[model samples]
Target: MNENEAGERQIDIMVCGAGYVGLATAVAIKQARPSLDVVLADAAPDGVWKKDGRASAIAAAACAMLQRLGVWDELEEGAQPITEMIVTDSRASDPIRPVYLTFSGEVEPGQPFAHMLMNRDLNGALRRRCDELGIEIHQGTPIAGLDRSGACAVATAKDNRRFSARLVIAADGARSRLRDWAGIRTVSWQYGQSGIVCTVAHERPHNGRAEEHFLPAGPFATLPLPGNRSSIVWTERTADAERLVNSDPFLFETELETRFGRHLGAITVESKPRAWPLGLTLARAFVTHRLALAGDAAHGIHPIAGQGLNMGFKDVAALAEVIVEADRLGLDFGQEDVLEDYQRWRRFDTVRMGATTDILNRLFSNDIAPIRLIRDIGLGIVDRMPGLKRDFIAQAAGKGGPMPRLLRGEAI
Candidate 1:
């Protein structure tokens, strides 16, 4: 550890952003090598992230990683497993929406392929683990910029506090200041669509099923939560999204029920509706010198595939393995060659997932007659092939191909 002229603190590793990815990276590294110094810094004040009402689908591979990190058990009580997935294509007002493809959401006999996890619960559990692991956490300390000229990367907080570390992980989200400081370019574009997020309570139970109804505007996904509640990710044009989000409660609920079938019965909003503009953001490179990008800072894809966080978790796993093994072999963990290994390990998979989501969003978020006919036929064909469906379920679960040891629930 080193100190500046002002005597600010320095550490071996600094993780910028206490969100799931940042926390996971810190905890995974600390657990694998307990003696290494790790610090987590976030832009938000303490307890501010609890206000995030959104939830994400945790893939089976991510569940395994969390379990290995000693956080999943704390989240199990609030986590809702998705037992099945159904996809359909039709207009929002269509009386009959035909089911296209169906997937049984199970990786094994008793293990679910994924779970709908409230963001607060996930972050809370991770914070507790960080506390137990003795990983230093600095709330309200956003990385305003980064300097990588010396052996250690220096991070300057918005408050002007300086933290120098052998390596810096930028989990600072989609618009990353550290990424820009590192001179890493990105490939990005807006979809002109926004996702409306909210939680809803209904009279009938959802039976652990998830549905994706492809409307002309975009896909409307209803993911089952515990009890009679479900989380909705409703996509629409930006203007329509704003109108629905700001609509009166009665008007909003009426519109929601139109797309959400009557099977749930008497649905009411359990949380305030919020809209997020949709887009695709992929960093041109994952690493530069001693700095590395993870999670949203590295890639942000459409929510249509629900793989955004999973991809981040994959980064956490791969980066942790690379660093831990390199240290075990007495190599410079922050050197360009070592960091390049991580870049090569994750860049290809990230690009592939981003492309897949972009294509799916374009294909489903349209109403061209011939295009619809062809897509429906493709969906039907896939639905008929049980073997193909199994492969897709595994793919979505993040269980296919070569994975980092942590994702396989093994220690680094």
Candidate 2:
């Protein structure tokens, strides 16, 4: 890694937080402009992502972007395709949970809407690409502060080391320190709910079908993983979530069985159950001065639609395009106009998705008879209308609206 010393440091871009978005952004930019100097840093030490047992749904468009970055071929086999999805609303003892809506997951020939893969696999691939691109990584280091008063932004590390760059990308998590340091405010709220995530081993295969059961408390999703295992995202009241997460294994499995059903035969938890607070967090502005926010730093929405990570990937694609173009044009990449282009391109989509997920969570997380009837009827209508369903499928596949060149598998 190149520190470049304090008074003479020169770098094109400095990306804070080595999470999925940070690494991807660094790799994408360096690959597009080999002469540019890029550096990625994270607070956590190296090999920390290996301990993350969670998985995510990578949408088709995100897959294409990864392929363009030379990371997808390594991820292809480790990913389990989601060929179909079914939604239902009912109680545990209702005899049957009527499927209100169903979707055929192909966005095109041989392309599925999404796939389930472990977080480590995705991060590892991006890290390898970063190495291949000669991008420097500052592991176990955090950007303590940013000094933007000079011609170039100077990021001061916790260890008192500094790196000067024309642009700074904050890919930190939802509670981003860089965002706060930049004087950026956010619109945020908690859902009074929590999502309990865990992986399960089953006797029978899920057959690439994902199921969502909207019970009184919240939505319960069984997403198909590779082999006869499936990943569970069960939403519940925050208090109840605490109890289940801290309860004995036997009690946990008992409650899980009630909602999981016997269709998959016997099921056992294969990983530790963890609960994450549900919420909506959107930055008031994505760019200010020479700094820009990406990933969860810009928006955090309920995972009901499973678009959180994919949306972050979209931000990566758009920001990379904007920055690369400005650099090639011999313009100031960190200028307000250049940064505004990225903000404009991504803000509308981010706001729309945050609102959509909020509405879905509110409409389905309760058991009011009247509201249930209305939503179920709405779902049925969507199911019966093939054209409407196709539109929705395309939207979920990240095929709707204007796409960045990287998302279309094109080089920036």
Whole-model lDDT per candidate:
0.92, 0.92
- For model 1, what is the alpha-carbon lDDT of residue 253? 92
- Candidate 1, residues 1-412: lDDT per residue as tens digits? 4677756567889999889999999999999999899999874687788999889999999999999999998899999999999999999888898999999989999899999999999998998899999998988767777889987888887888888889999998999988888899999999999999999999998899999999999999999999999999999999999999998999999999999989878898999999999999999999988989999999999999889999999999999999999999999899989999999999999999999999999999999999999999999999999999989999999998899998999889
Candidate 1 colliding pairs: none
TM-score of the candidate numbered 1? Answer: 0.98
Model 2 per-residue lDDT tens digits across residues 280-387: 999999998889999999999999999999999999999999999999899999987889999999999999999999999999988899999999999999999999
RMSD of each: 1.2, 1.3
Write down the TM-score of every candidate.
0.98, 0.98
